[model samples]
Target: MPTGSGANQATFAGELSVDGSTVSIRRDTDVASERVSVSLPAVVSVTDQTGEARYPAFKAIMGAKKKPIQTMSLADLGVDAAQVGWSGASSKVVDVSPTPARTAGTIVNDDGTGAAQLADFLAGRGFI
Candidate 1:
């Protein structure tokens, strides 16, 4: 995002310790890293770096198995079903089409003009 890594974000956010309802999330990219603060009631995805996961014991598993499973719906959660998928999303796939078939690439022969030809090819493709 804006820092280099989660380590950088953590270092910036004081080990990600939040003082209020807002929580800091680590957003990272190759060129940058960022510390983003999301308020309560927001959707968030956490990583193992955030905290350690406690394994369930056999007794806990048996107790969970005995408990009746509760089924919940998006409606019950005050969420519309359509709002979660691609259709009602803020971003959408405007169009999609099958990929064009691959064609044979131009070859550069060991001729004196090979360098010039390669340069022209690269320049034509905006790769120069």
Candidate 2:
């Protein structure tokens, strides 16, 4: 990936989940997603199987709180010398958008009669 100043680049390979609107990233196998509303116990039990470097990982996590992150010019990091930016990156955004709005309406519950009411409501809009 092309690296440069003003570039917001972060590298992470781990399981993640979203609880409602909050996202939780786990370095272990306990992955969860509100979109799916489920936990992958089998997946969580397999993080050790990868057998990746652990010491560097420990240092990285520990360094986050104590280390003084220095802000330097791109030339100091050799990025400016290489002139890496969007021009150097392999990917470019062509277009972007948000998901379309839901066309369905809420179903009002009238106790045990909610089923028939729901059907009638949807049929009124030809949604059935």
Candidate 3:
């Protein structure tokens, strides 16, 4: 995710739908948003914006202690540790700096010559 979602709803879960044996995840793009469905028993990941977090009640917290806990490792999941760690990464970020300030945009005055001004502006920017 070198160039990440970048302030946009790159991977927003606009909505989620689940059934006994299937799941739905939202996919959004510049053109449209889509719902992708897959069979159940799958691995899924979502960002913080997926939904609001809820604190576990004291009773629920107590009950969790009585429940069985299952744990899996990278090998169990068929993922190689080296593939996901910085030690095996192909690139490292060496530095970060503040972005340069943007220049002010030109103002167009609408008068008898407004259209001509617009054409000139577009041509100057190679947009025409």
Ranking by TM-score: 3, 1, 2
Error of 2 at 20 (Å): 37
Best-performing candidate as measured by lDDT? 3
C-alpha lDDT (0 to 100) for residue 127 of candidate 2: 98
- Per-residue lDDT tens digits for candidate 1, residues 1-128, read 22332222223332254548776766565688777875654445555565667999999998998998889988898878788977678986789999999999977686799889989998999999
The 10-residue segment of model 3 with minimum total lDDT is 1-10
| Highest-TM-score candidate | 3
Residue 41 C-alpha lDDT in model 1: 45
Question: Candidate 3, which segments miss by more than 4 Å at Cα?
Answer: 1-12, 47-50, 57-87, 100-128
Q: Candidate 1: TM-score?
A: 0.41
Cand. 2 Cα-lDDT = 0.53
Candidate 1 residue spans exceeding 4 A from truth: 1-17, 72-128
* Shift of residue 106 alpha carbon in model 1, Å: 30
With candidate 3 superimposed using the best TM-score fit, by how many Å does residue 88's alpha carbon deviate from the native? 1.4
Model 3 C-alpha lDDT per residue in residues 86-118, reported as the tens digit of each score: 967999999999999999987877988989998
In candidate 3, how many Å is residue 50 off? 4.1
Preferred candidate (TM-score higher): 1 or 2: 1
